[model samples]
Target: MRETLGAEDPSLEVTDLDAATAAPGDLSTLASPSLFGEPRLIRVGGVERLSEAFLNEALRYVESPADGATVVLRHAGGVRGKKLLDAVRGGAGGGIEVPCAEVKRDADRSAFASGEFRAAGRRVAPGALRVLVSAFQGDLAELASACQQLIADTTGDIRESTVQTYYAGRMETDAFAVADAALAGRAGEALVLLRHAIDSGADPVPIVAALAMKLRSMAKVLDAKGPAARIASEHGMAPWQIDRARRDAQGWETAGIGRAIVFAAETDERVKGAARDPEYAVERLVRFIAARGGAG
Candidate 1:
């Protein structure tokens, strides 16, 4: 969400629905241009708890999304505005839905954790990672946080005992978080999350998958001569995805993007057991992508 917001308009007004005096009418402010004609990002949090008036405003505004105004309505899911959500999701209203679904199964939670570490260029044994996930259970965010803490406190391979000692009762992280940090070239931060994730039991395959998706988006649009929307349409991706890829791909040359694709393929093989150490393979992949270069 932050990535999309930053890409569209860095200068935005953040208004929580609970705090806003005119929650419904605030949509109008976004639709109308500023006196100085500056573009804006108008983010409204807590759409799930929106009052009747606020819901109405959202429905009406979504009918014709404001030009040059990014109105981000965050819905955490519920019964209050099911119709409105359906309308928006059905594309009766424009904009995309980035779902943050809850992780239910142990396998899924483990996969999530592994992806986190793989993205950050870290390695942890599969057994250790599963133990970490069991410790966190239902709190994915905390699991990811624990991954970062683990990386900060330890070095080299993260072991099962490490997960037992530090994150038995606490810790957290996510794959998207990993990709964001990596693409932004913040290797240290990414690695911290990566270790935490692997420790918590995220699967390396999904981590590789995330990197592949990001690189594929970057490759599809790189040097493609057209409007972003048109290019995205040609590539069968959402405009926002293209927009995000463009922003994340900044400072990356065409060759770098290509090389990342190759690394992504190799990592896929390694994570699937082409190598003895899937953890090491993923770590290498993360390092290469984060560097935006091929192996020297």
Candidate 2:
């Protein structure tokens, strides 16, 4: 938003104030019409922990906002200043609220990354988006930063290889890579990656969790029919997931996918605590899946 505002007017002045330490009349002074009358943006953060003076002043300022100034009050969702929130939300200031909810779900994060590319007038392959999302997982800020970096540093349509080139050796991507190798019957490479991941301080829990997630996806697409996109929607999966699972399902029987799922569950338990040698248990799980749930 700040970038957009700046792009529109290079002379746009921005003032950042902390509601927690703001003195009385600070807002009014900045918000009041300047002699030069340049466009200004007043950003007040920590509104959720606003001081009494700020709260009182803000309530009044909202009623009669300054011209040529955009006063943005950022409250991170709390009841600290209910009166101000109510007044602003009740249309007293004719302001629109932009909600910044936490992005916790995989689908939401995928959508976020896609939106970032779309906003930049760029395109990312679904596989690239998938791996990028898995690579960042829980850190939306990091994901957004990664997207921005890619947009700024690279050119052309983003592909899976692009993401892998940028973030191949990360722990998260390594986990998924190990799973992919194992499920595709590349046991030797999978085991090597698995040990390397562990040596790099990657926890066995997430490694096993990654394997289990793939196993579940494989199982879900076992008997699925129709177009990949339609089947993916029915099974709550991405089209890429369905396509990848189908490719991994080749040369494997129904019983094999089922057995792999069971072994994944067992390995998940062992890695959590059931087995003293969790590393060994995961190796066995990899070998089992690599054999397509048959004798190695």
Candidate 3:
């Protein structure tokens, strides 16, 4: 549907629901166009947050959407927003629900990389694809950005070396790399990358945010208190991923995790200008976390 729409349309109205509210008037304007003419496409984004009233109205319109009008809804996949999803599925109409799950595995990352290459009207070698997947890991937005950067930075075809060169300094910009290194007990390497990140002008807040996310994931594994196999099965994660998280969690007691959370909060305050030398603050945080991990 998107392919056809992209090929046939010259104009598209893509709205981000996170940035826009959908009211009855808005839907009315969408359903009934101006006296001037018709739009080629009308997309309603962030559909997960649409109000119940707006959703019902939009569903009604979907039953008989205007000619040449295409309605695209972007949902980040939430079961709590299932009411409208059920309505769309049960309705006698064509609809698509793009599930944007977080990528975590090598196979999933390869699929995404290939899809991006295809989207850009290009081809990637198998070895090059593997390199791209490893370099970008599992973040869709980052992968997409890297694809755009590569497309602009190179011509003809993208190769493994191209990916390697483009990603030479990616570790400094990628907060996940820092978290992964730290979680794997590579404190010295993580500290070096953390320092490089600060020197390369990466903001401290996002680094802290990424670290908090890693800590929270570890805490989830710890608090699950279930067998690693059971937790992996229940969470749809690989046993290795679960086991690695378990080991990482062992390096921090509950009290230690609590203190890290507090430290993150203070670092956040400092980054927001409540304190001076945000870089030094984050450096101290990294050392403190490494010390805690070493103690464990």
Candidate 4:
């Protein structure tokens, strides 16, 4: 939003103030035009914690906004600034509310990543986007930063290999590596990677979660019929994911996959504090899956 305003007004003078710390006359002083008369943008944060004086001034200012100045009051949801919020919503100051909600779901996060690339006029392959999403699942800010770095540092279309090149050492990537090694029946390699991940301060929970995701993907595609793309759409998975899971299931029996899935769930619980030794629990899971060649 600030970017849009800056693009529209080249000389936009941006001022940031915390409503909790703002003084009595701070709003009036900034709202008033300068001698040069450049358009001003006043972004006031933490309005939910606004001082009494700031609240009174904001209520009045919103009713009759200053010319050549746009004041944005950011209030995280609360009743602390109900009067000011109500006045603004009732059409005082011609103010409009813009809600910045939390992004939690994988699909939502993926869409956000896609938007970041689209906004930069860049093209990212679906497989690359999946890798990027998986590599930074829990941190939206980091995901956005990774997308931007990819946009700025590289040229042309982004690929799966490109994401791997940049984020191979990331914890999530490492977790997936552990999963891949275990699924490929390489118990020793998976154990080494698992120990390294834990020693690197990787959380056991996400590691187990990564294992669960990989195991569940295989289960979903186990008996799935039709084209990869069609099945992927039906299951809310990427085609690449469907193809990879199918390949990973080549040497596995149905009963083995089921057992692994159940074990993955138990490991997930253990890592989330259900057991006394989470790391030991994770090692057990890695060896178990590898022993069965990731069958279930």
The candidate maximizing lDDT is 2
Rank all candidate structures by their TM-score, best first, as comma-separated numbers: 2, 4, 3, 1
lDDT of 2 by residue, 124-191 (tens): 99889989998998546568778978998899999989998998766788899898899899999999
Badly placed stretches (over 4 Å) of model 2 are 1-108
Give lDDT per model, in order.
Answer: 0.70, 0.85, 0.65, 0.84
Model 4: CA > 4 A from native? 1-88, 98-105, 139-142, 160-170, 293-296
Candidate 1 lDDT over 1-296, as tens digits, reads 43455557656443333412455576777567777665666666556667788777777877887666766666656786676778778885566777877667555666677776776568987557755765575546556667767877888888878876775433222555566678778778878877777887887777777777778888877777778778765765545556777888898889998988888898898889898998788778778888986562
1-296 in candidate 3: lDDT tens per residue?
44566666545443222213676656646646546554545555556566776777776776776765566665555664576677667753576556566677555666766777787688777646645654565345557567767876788778867776778565433565676666666779878988877777777877777777557657668778777768766765545556666777876687777777677777778878977788787776676666653332
Model with the higher lDDT, candidate 1 or 3: 1
Give the number of colliding residue pairs in candidate 4.
6
- Decide which is better by lDDT, 3 or 4: 4
Off by over 4 Å in 3: 1-173, 184-186, 227-243, 293-296
**Residue lDDT tens for model 4, 180-229:** 89988889999999999889888888888888888888988988888998
Give the per-residue Cα lDDT of candidate 2 at 104.
Answer: 70
| CA lDDT for candidate 4 | 0.84
Error of 2 at 45 (Å): 11
